[model samples]
Target: MFKVYATTPESMGPCGIAAHAARAEAMGFDGLHVPDAIHDGLLLAALALQATRRLRVGTSVLVAFPRSPMTVAVAAWDLQQLSGGRFELGLGTQIKQNIEQRYSARWDSPVPQLREYVQSLRAIFDSFQHGTPLRFEGEHYRFTRLQPFFNPGPIAHPDIPLLCGAVGPAMTRMVGRIADGMITHPTNTPPEYLRTVCLPRLRDGLERAGRDPAALRLILGPLVATGVDEQAVAQQWEQQRRLLGFLYSTPAYWPSLELFGWQARGAELQALTREGRWQDLPAVVTDEMLSAFVPRGSYAEIAEVLRARYAGLADSITFPMPQDTAQDTQAAAAIARLRA
Candidate 1:
């Protein structure tokens, strides 16, 4: 069965996260994927976990560079313990400009930095689990001390499944080499992009690491524009198109555009952003480009469309909760079919 996870919108209020998670569980979703956008992702995850008994909570992902590995490990450990081993830690390295400017965090070579981050987190978790010495020295990060006094010793769930977000080749390969699983960024979640670009690099990494092909999990969070009917789908399409226009403007996410010979369109979007033309961004996203990022249909058939599109491609996928609670059953039906 392909697991289906619930995702929240960027505009959702913090107080709504718990209610959303409860609804997702009631709707039969396997898990909830929270974002580190307007609200702290872990805090939101805590809310969700507290509100639901069985639904797993994970960060779609949490930004890694801005916080220390040990700090993050401690939080993740506690969340895992609290969730009864239901928490998955998914980390992502935001692009340089966002890291340096928006986050006021140091930005270096991200592939290696994130690799070291994941390794250091495991080393810390190991020490916390078994009374062993904590020593992980990497080019980007070094952790040689974990005094027993400071160490939050062992939880029942010692193995917190470490997931990484990846879209580029270097990052995807690194994730396959180190991550227990990977969360595909929305911009890079199309079926063709996964088959032609991501899977090959991932296999190369898995081969390099001498790991079993099936051991690593791949979760595709593709942008989907589906609703109860044609009118609803069209509304969702427009919303997703505007979102894609904003996302593809980032050069790091342009690999998908390049794959489809739409790099020029990507550049045009970027130029619009550079000129501070925020309102014009949506206009630049044509139907053709929108179709690449978002698969459109009614909820009645969207699951079949996705199943056929990603049949053997992904182990898990993300489905967002509808803004209106009235349409949840319609969305839930699709989620159930995907999970089946």
Candidate 2:
């Protein structure tokens, strides 16, 4: 069956989180992905888990650089156990600047760091499950012995799935080679690019690792806004476009957007940023750009578009809900239509 996953913004208020999770669970959503940004992802996940019983709660991504692997392992394991195995730990290595400036942590060689991080997490989980001594020494991390005091106890299913949020070829392949799934970023990737470029790289990596590509889950991340008012929806899209435009102009994000033929607009977006004319973004964003990136329309139209766009490649399509609106009703209605 095609799965439907909804994305929760990083800054979602407590009421918003509870309301969305409750509605999504009632609406029969497959999962709820909470993004990791300037907020505490684990805290939010705990809240969501408490709020909904059936829905699988996940972190859209928890940056590896911010905290130690041991810390992440314990928290994820605890959450999984607490949620009755209804948790997926989505991991990612954010850009260097965020890692350094925001998290106040070191950033170096993400691929290797990611590998070691996963390995360490697995080791910790294994130690708890099999009652074996856990000791791992990698270039990035080392653990001679993990105390039982730190263990979160056994889970109904100790094997918590790890999903990596990656975009570049190396990271995409790495996700295929190691992670249980890959979560594609929304800034620039189109559905076809995921099917052609990202999926192929992932498949090749899986082949090299003697793993089946079909076993890996593919998650398509897109900014979603749905409303009764078309003009309001368009304005929301414009705001999203400006934010995405700024992201597109960045060195890290530019490469991805450039691949999707969005590089030319980078200069104009940069100019907008320089002049503090963000409100003028709507005028500059062409219809083609909106079609290629942001998904906008009435609830039914947007849901159908998402279903069609994701089609066969993704196991789930994750749509982020805006904060200002009453998303429960719209989300429930959309899910009912999509499932039907």
Candidate 3:
């Protein structure tokens, strides 16, 4: 069984995020994983950590390519200090178009680049904490400058955990080799895919690096349909269908589908996106596929379902906070069960 985290919804601004974090803490969630999509992840983390007393605040993934490692290190360091060691920084490399066009950041050689980014962050942390003289030279990034006046200097907690979002083998392997943890993409967390592809690849990297597999946190952020009753559960299942319809449209996420002989369905979803048939997309995901991916049960039983599904695989799992505040009590009860 794995501990549950509140997966903070995307597109929320500062106040909403703080409120959500406070609510999650009140509900007994061990942590909140905030997104870096529409807003600054670091800023959201600051608010989330400040608002909550005991809940861990982490960026589910803050895009790594757009921001300099030095900038991220400083922000993460400060958040760790302020949170009394409950801040985690999860990093990711966005696709080329978004990285280059949307963010206006140079994008090339992502796996290596991300590997270097993690290394660079660690080096910067070392310099900041112990004054070890920052010198991380890699193809994508190089940092050799750190004046004593500019350095933020040591904090009470210097061993900040660095997590990464990874789906592909290379990125997953890199995560095992370097990062403190790996957060699975929602589409890539099906048990068979993880057992066959992800865990093995991660172990390869861990073996190469001579790091213990137990040290790597494998968090499964799967889609689960939970509610007080069947009707409410159905609503969540439908929502997941629409979300998956949008997500699988990206070919980059097709490998998991390919493993399950659903690659053609992924292509079909992509075709619908290309044809701009957004409304029709959800219909493409059949009930069979939905059942295969999502766990659906009442809040009272969903924890057992998750345990049966993910035990011995994921070190932690994420369960979404209910969209309606009315459902908070049931959702909170479910989280408590998961934690226990």
Candidate 4:
């Protein structure tokens, strides 16, 4: 089945995460994805896991560069065991500035560094599971010590799945090679981007790893604008327009915009941002641009659109829940037919 996931609402506090999880489960959501923004996604995932019985919880995704591999391994390992193997450790190398300035951490070749990071994590998990020595030596990271005193020992669920959030081809290929799944960045995607840029690189990586392309989970978190009425669709479109303008300002994510010869548009947005003209940014994102990022339609039309766009390409999808009760009901019905 193609899994349907709902993102954890940022308005929820620590105690509210559990309630949100329970509600999402009742809504027929297959899983819950907690994004690492201002809040601690790991702690939130734990809370959600503790609350729900069958719903899978994942960090979509946690910033990996800020923490050590051993630290991530321990957290995911414990969570996996606690959740009876329902925990997925979704991680991402969140750009250079966020790592260097915000976290006060060093940043280097992200793809290779992340590859080493995942390998180190797997090695540590291996030691915990099989009582082996912890000795993982890599170019970017090294973990030669895991004393018995610090070890959590073996658990029933030792093979914790690793998911990576990626946009660039190199990082996407790395995900195909080393990760159980790839979480595509919401702002840097479309069906065309997936088929042309992401899939080719991923196929090459899967071939190198001697793995099947169909085996890897491709999770899409696209900006979707769907509603019961024109007014609601317009509201969602406005929100998506502002978001696209903000995201397109980042030059690093210009490839998707570049595909449609909109590199100049990205540059214009970047210029506006650098000039501190925040209000002017949204004005630059035209309706045509908004359509590229967010597909606008009625709630009843969404399922067919999603399948026509992402069928066979994506294994899962994450989107915002409609605020209108009747619209939400129709959307739920449509989403149920996504995998069928």
Q: Tell me how far the alpha carbon of residue 116 in candidate 3 is from the true structure, in angstroms, after superposition.
A: 0.3
**lDDT (Cα, 0-100) at 5 in candidate 2:** 85
The residue-by-residue lDDT of candidate 4 on 101-138, one tens digit each, is 99999899999999998899999999988879989888
Kindly state the number of residue pairs that clash in model 3.
Answer: 0
TM-score, prediction 2 = 0.90
Q: Candidate 3: where is the Cα deviation over 4 Å?
A: none
Q: Which of 1 and 4 is the better model by lDDT?
A: 1
What's the true lDDT of residue 110 in model 3?
94
lDDT of 1 by residue, 4-118 (tens): 9988886666789889999999999999999997889989888889898999999989999999999999999999989999999999998898899999999989999999999
Q: Model 1, stretches more than 4 Å misplaced? A: none
Give the count of colliding residue pairs in each prediction.
Answer: 0, 0, 0, 0
**Candidate 3 per-residue C-alpha lDDT over 155-225 given as tens digits, one digit per residue, 9 for 90 to 100:** 99899999999988899999999999999998888888889999999999999999998899988899999
The candidate with the higher TM-score, 3 or 4, is 3
Clashing residue pairs, backbone N/CA/C < 3 A, model 4? none
Q: CA lDDT of 184 in candidate 4?
A: 87
Off by over 4 Å in 4: 323-328
For model 2, which pairs clash? none
